[model samples]
Target: MSSRSYDIAVIGAGVIGAAIAAQLSRYAVRVVWFEAAHDVAEGASKANSAIACTGFDMAPGSLESDLILQTNPQWENICRALDVPLRRIGALSLAFDDGDSDSLRNLLNQAREAGIEAELIAGDALRREARTAAPSAIEALHVPREGIIDPIRLTVGLAKLAVLNGVELRCSTPVTGFRHHPSGAISHVVTPTGATAVGAVVNAAGVNADLITDAAVAEPFTMWPRKGQFLLLDRAVGHLVPKIMCTAPTPHTRGIYAVPTTNRTVLVGPTAVDGDDRGDKTTDGDTLDAVWARAERLLPEGVERRHVTKTFSGLRPASDRTYRIEVSAKVPNLVHAAGIRSTGVSAAPGVASYVADLIGAEVMELPVKSSVRESIPVIPRLAEIDTDVAATAFTARPGAAPDEHPIVVCACEHVTAAEIAAECRGPVPATSLDGVRKRTRATAGRCQGAYCSVGVSFILSAATGDQPGEVRHGEPGSHWETPVR
Candidate 1:
C-alpha cells in the first residue's frame, strides 16, 4: 500500500474542516485534508439554511455566540477574497402573538447584551417595509446584518484555496484509525487508501467526530445526527421572499425559516429532528408538510407547492455540550473542532482562526508565510453575467480547452457547457454529478435534472473518460444506467 507523511492532518471536508484547512494553509506548514465522501461539502455543508447569521440573538458569552460575533464582521471581505456569492439582504423574526412578541423583546435584549444591532419593529411597520411578510405577525425583530450566502460555494472555495496553497486534499479518504506515539501524540492516521504519518490531528468530522475522538481516547461527549429536512422552491418564487423570514425560537430549535439563496431561489423548511443514525438523511412527507405550513405563515401569497423544486435533508453534529474547540488533554496533538451545530456556516471563520491558534500554541509552531495568496480569481457563471464587463470577462483556465460554442446545458439555471466542463476539469475536479451541481448549479434548478441530467452525464463521461453507464450521479457505486434507446 502507498503511504505518505504530513505535518498536520485535518479530517472531514465539510464547511468547518475546509475553513480550518484554508486558514492553516496561509502558514508554513504541510497540511493534508481527508474526506470520506466523493467531494467536499458532501455532508452537512451540502444542505443548510444558507443564512449568514449575525449572532444578534445568540446566548451571551457562549462559544457559539462569541465565535459568530467575531466572524460576522469579516464575511464581506471573506466572501470577496474567496469569490463566494453573498447577499447582505438582512433577516426578520416574525412574532405571531403576545408570547412571541415577548420573545422578540428578549432576543433584542440578548442582542443588546452581545453588542449586536437589532430592533423590534411593529407588525404594521414590518409589513409596510417588507411587503412579503405575513400580516398576522404582530411584531418583528430585524437584524440588519443577517444575510444569505452560497454555503456549498463557500465550503468549496475554502477547500480550493487550501489546495492552491499547497495543502494536499485526499477526497474519498476516511481516517479509520489513529496510531499514537508513546507520549500519547498521534503518530499516524490510517485510512482505506493508506496510512499517513502526521505530527498532529484535527477532528472536525461533524457527527462522526466523536467517533474519531473516542478512537484515540475516551471522549467526554457523544454525538448524534440532528436531521433537518428542507424544501427548495424554484427561482420563480425568489422575488416573493426578499429576505430571511424566521419564526420565534423554541428552546430546542431556531424553528422553521424561509431564506433566499444566492442562486436566486428561496429555501424553506429544516425540521430539526434528533436521532442516532448519522447516515439517515431521508425526508418524510409528513415532516416536510408541517415545515411547509410554518413557511406559508411567513412568506407571501405567491409561494405554492408547484414552485417546489427540491427536497433534501442534512445531519448536523448534535452533542450534549456546546461548541467544542479545544486540544485534547489525553492526546496533546489532537484538536477538537466538533459539535458545531447549525450555525457552523456562520461560525466557520471564527472557529477556524480559534482552532489555528490552539494548534499553533499547543500542537506545533505554525510560522506565518512571508507571502500568501489572499484571493483566487472569480469565475463568473452564466447566471451572474449581467454587466458588460462580466460578459466580456470570461477566460478559460490555463489547461482548459477553449469553448468555441458555449452551449447551454442546464436551461433552468442558465448553466453553460463551458461551466460544466470547467468544474469537471477544475483543480478540485468534480468526480460526481452532485459535485458538478454544487460547483456550477448545473442540475439543481427548476427541472431538478429532469431535462439536464442526460446532458450533464455526457459531460461527466467525457471529462472523466467514463462510459455512458459509468457516469455516477453522486458517490461511489451510484452510476447511472444509460437508456436502451
Candidate 2:
C-alpha cells in the first residue's frame, strides 16, 4: 500500500545498521531504516557488556580486529557529534593464578601486535590500581584504549541523526523476505507492512540476518544465539572500580568483568551460554549465581548482591568463523554484514565505512547531497547538566524542573514532566515506558520502575492522547498485556 522507494535500505536498526544508515545519509541517496522491534536497539544492541574495546583481545588481522583498530580512535568525535556519553576509563585484567599470568603475557604481546599500547604492572602498582581485585592477584594487564559506552544511547542517537539527515525510519516493520531482480540482485524487500524496492540493500539484521538472506545467497556464516547474563550494580559503589576490571578468557567465555558504566554504575558478568533459540535472552538461576561469584572473586570488597539494581541478559549473534563483512557474491547488490559477535558495538563505525563504500560503488550513481547535517542537538539530562545550564533550561519553561513545579515523574533519576513529554515526541520518539527509559533514564534508577511507572504511564497517556490502560509498555502484546489500539 506504500508507494515510497529508496536507493538504499538498511535492514536493522541496531548499532551497525544505525551507523550504516547515518553514514549513508552523508550522501544524497535515499536511505530508510527498518526495525522489527518497537524501537531501535531492542535487540542485543540494548543489552550486553557495553565495552568500547580497543580490539586488543581480538585475533590479530581478523575482520573484527582490523575494524576495531581502525575505528577505535574515532569514537571521541563520533560520540561527541552523536551526543552519546563515552569515556576512556580503560581496563585492567588481573592474573590471579599461573594460567592467568601466562594469558596476561600473551595478551600483552597480542596488544603490541594489535597496535594498542599496554603495560603489565605488579607489586605495589598493581595493588594500588586494583584495590578491589582479588587478593590472589599477582599482576595486571592495563590497556588504556578500551573504554565504556552507553550502547542504547549510541544506537538511538545515530537513528535520530540519520532521521535528521533525511533518512526514513520505520519501527515495528519486519522484513518478511527479499524479492530479487532478474540479475539475481535484490530488488524488493517484502515486509508485513509493505514492500520497498531499492537499488541496494545491506543485511545487518543481527541474529535474524541469515534468515533474511533467503534462497538467493548462501551465507558464509552460521549464527547461533550466545546468551550473556549481566548484573547492574547501583552507582553508589561505581567509584570503587575506576577502570574496567576483568579476568582472562576461558575456552568459550570472555570471563567475568565489572566495568563502570557511563551513568556512574557498574556492570558485571555476562556469562556466555550458547543456545539454539535466538529469542532466548532469559538468565538461569545457576548462571547468574556463578556470574556474581566470579565478579566477587575479581572485585574483593565492593561487589554486593544487594546493590544490584537489575539483572538482565542479551543474545549475541555468535558464529564459529570470524566476522563476515563483505558484499554477497551470490546475491548482487546485497552486502553481508552479519556475525559481528560481541564486538559489534565497538566496530560499528568500521562496518559503516565498508557498507558505505559498497553502496557507493553498487548504487546506480546515487546523487550525493550538497550538504549533510552530521550532528544532533544534545538532550540535557537533569542529573548530568551543570547548575547554570539547568537554570537556563528551567528558566525557558519554569515548570521544566521537578522542584520548580510538582510535575515530577521519575524521582529516582530526577526526571521531570517536561523531559518525559519531550522524549515521547522527539525525532526518534519513545513509544513505551522502556523506550522512555532508554532515551531519558527515567525508570532506570534504583527503584527500577517501582517509583516512576504510574507517573510515567500517565505522562505517556497525556503525551499520546491515549487512555491510561491503553498505553502499552514497549510494544503491542508486551508483558503489560494492555488492550491494543
Best candidate according to lDDT: 1
Q: What Cα-based lDDT does every candidate model obtain?
A: 0.87, 0.83
TM-score of each: 0.96, 0.94
Model 1 earns a TM-score of 0.96
TM-score (C-alpha, index-matched) for candidate 2: 0.94
- Candidate 2 lDDT by residue in tens digits, 136-254: 77888998778899999999898988999999999999888778877888878888877888878888899888777763464556778888899999988888878899998756666
The parts of candidate 2 lying over 4 Å away from their true place are 215-221, 362-367, 395-408, 479-485
Cα RMSD of predicted structure 1: 2.1
Candidate 1's error at 138, in angstroms? 1.4
